[model samples]
Target: MTFQEITKDEFAQFSRQYSQSFLQTRQMAEMLEKRGYQPYFVGIKQNDELKLAAFMTSLKVFGGLKFELNFGPIGQANEAELASFYKGLKAFVADHQGLELRTYPDSNYRTYDPKGEAIDQPNERAVEQLKSYGFDFVVRHIGFDEQDVVAEWQYIKDLAEISDEETLLKSYNSNAKRNVKKAIKNAVSVRVADFDELDKVEKLIEGTGEKRKFATKDLSYYQELHQAFGDKAEMLLTEVEGKAIAAGVFIEVGSEFLYLYGGSDGAYGKLGGPFLLQHTAMLHALERGLKSYNFYGISGKFDGSDGVLRFKQNFGGYITQKLGEFAYYPSKTKFKLIDILKKITGRK
Candidate 1:
């Protein structure tokens, strides 16, 4: 088997034939590039058949960032093929002195076992297999049942065949309506900023990180997104008393309106700044005829009862249990050493 890197243009060509989730799309990768991430691709071919492939996107930290060997939209391959692909991947990255290569498949492999049957919840077999390869498993708060209330609002496009406003409002929880009204009473303004406002939007993100104890990318990163996505991307900012209080940047990827990055001023939380910002985005999505509004990346640890989960529930979205990282680490010595440590620590 041969593994080779493809150009961005080449990857774009491959995307059409092979299906991928929004995260693996070139647009999303470009979004990450705007945030200064280094993205690359690797494909395995043997005698004219492209049997397997992977995406490696690196975030270079001063110390070290978690490097992932993401499987992209391709779910579980034939076990033998996947194993061979993993071996080649391990060899190639090891030669290049790669650090912690995590495999986060774009598909939700955990939700369904190898036989393609939905288990009661996430399967433990795949998690155990990856662990044997010296990979850490994160049993985080990220799973969702399709029948749950949050899932109904999230997958509204599927909840009912109709897109009429009256029908949709009936689907929303009472609390969601109350928050929307509260945001209006607070005089919070939500509008999509033009691409020219990238600078201000970037500042909002940076300011939000500082005030809320989160991380942010450089301003130039977002500027590039506006240049690339043009009108397809949007930066929504909310303000009160002429001060920027809340901001979120989202992109319409395929049928899903992804909630990419969001932040709000700590002082404005009580004023319903974020509530207004999110509600306005949803309305804008409806206007554009989008299928669903995804409040992305909830904690996998939170049960159906957590306040944070309840907050997202107000948006009326569904929970999707996405597969986490998996990888095959070479170096028998290092692999075995880490395996012992992990077994003793009982940490994934």
Candidate 2:
């Protein structure tokens, strides 16, 4: 068996033909590379025929030496096929003198326990396949599902069919529109910002991350994404009395609009500014005819956790489980050492 890089046309064709669990489009790879990451394609072939496939991307941090492949959507691989694929990947990493290959498999994350009785619900067979390959269980987030308010987004629609006000008032629920109106009444203005205003947007991101205790990339990342995706990426700001109170950084892919990051001034919590910003972004998305606006990660740990669930529910979108990362560690010692370090640092 050998590995080869599949061309973009071949990759696209394969995606349309197969029922893979995850779809990491080639356009996304180009976007990642534009953001200063090294992206590669791997095709595991057997008997002169392609058997399995995967896409890998790495970002150089703290200089080019320290690197990690954040996520790779590995094409379907059975038990033995997976084993051989990992062996080949390990050899490739070794040949490149890579210190480590950290993969977040898009199909599975945190699927098994040490005893391997399926510590989690084993949502799919692929989840078990990941366990068979010996991946550590990690809990990065929990998800939410509110079905009563489910709605689909459309990227292109006749404006005459559903105007902005009609979609905003209907899609966001009655109260959501009220809050937006309250924001405008309370002197909050939402507007799109030029690339030069990234500094202010970055400040909002930092503030939001600090408050939420999550990770955030620097302004350069957002700038690069905007440059690469053009009109699809938007940086929006909400100001009160001429002071920036809230901001949103988002990207639109086909009919899907993702709210990648959002934050507001903690000091202005009384004005309901953050909610206004969120609703406004949703309104804009609906106006543009997006199919669905993904609020990103919701706290899945709390199955009945109303607080977090309710936060996302107001947007009128159904919550569904999207798969997370899976990885194959080449060195047992390195894997163990990193797992120990992650545990010591309170990471799952």
Give the top-scoring candidate (TM-score): 1
lDDT tens digits, residues 162-204, model 1?
3665555565579766666787798878877776776677877
* Residue 95's lDDT in candidate 1: 67
Assess each prediction's global lDDT (C-alpha) against the native. Answer: 0.60, 0.59
| Candidate 2 structure quality by residue, lDDT tens digits, 243-263 | 888888877655656777777
Worst 10 residues of 1 by lDDT: 146-155
| lDDT, residue 286, model 2 | 72
Candidate 2 lDDT at 257 equals 66
**Full-model lDDT, candidate 1:** 0.60
Candidate 2 positional error at 328, Å: 1.8
Off by over 4 Å in 2: 7-37, 44-54, 59-71, 74-91, 94-99, 108-124, 133-168, 171-175, 301-310, 321-325, 333-348
Taking the candidates one at a time, how many backbone clashes does each contain?
Answer: 15, 13
